[model samples]
Target: MNTPPSKDALREFLASKFAEAVEQNPDAVVLYAAERAPDPKRYVKRPTVQEVAFKRELEKMRDDQADKAAPESATSVSPAIRTNQLSLDDYPGLVLPGKHNEF
Candidate 1:
């Protein structure tokens, strides 16, 4: 990997190290990250416009679908959508042989 430390992160690290060094030995000169500035030319490449737009469009579509679904979930019933429920006696061998002992 060509990942070198960023300048701010490296500076923070050195500053902490410098503090630790002085706490341990006051006369010690532990210099680091003096010229280790982060290079924009070596920065990680950003996502392309098409990729960002596609992600945004997909998210918007999903949000619109969720919004469309939310209105149909009301508890009010108009007797048009029929629902049927069955007991265990309706289906034979649906329960395991061991599980049938408890029921």
Candidate 2:
């Protein structure tokens, strides 16, 4: 009666077998591995011209809506006026006689 190999022995045997197979026909093993690999092309779908055009149109519509929602007077502002209402007494360091008497 034959006894089964231990897990370590089995793993080593399998690794040696795989290495031997890889050495024998490298291209075939590569192709086989590639076949088993997850296909990025399978998940890829081409976007139609209409779909691209529609997305562009939607973006343009959003920009137009933003422009329309803005206030009409957004750029409008009155110019600053020059005034002579200020006096020499309003300026700093102008000494007034009765000003410190109140403090």
TM-score of each: 0.35, 0.31
Candidate 2: which stretches are off by over 4 Å?
Answer: 1-41, 72-103
Worst 10-residue lDDT window for candidate 2 reads 75-84
Q: Which stretches of candidate 1 lie over 4 Å from their true place?
A: 1-42, 76-81, 84-103
lDDT of 2: 0.73
Model 2, position 89, has a per-residue lDDT of 46
**Candidate 2 at 91: error in angstroms?**
41
Candidate 1 backbone clash number: 0
TM-score between model 1 and native: 0.35
lDDT leader: 1
lDDT of 2 by residue, 1-103 (tens): 9999999999999999999988997875633334566656656677899999999999999999889867544744322212446555456676666665654
Whole-model Cα lDDT per candidate? 0.79, 0.73
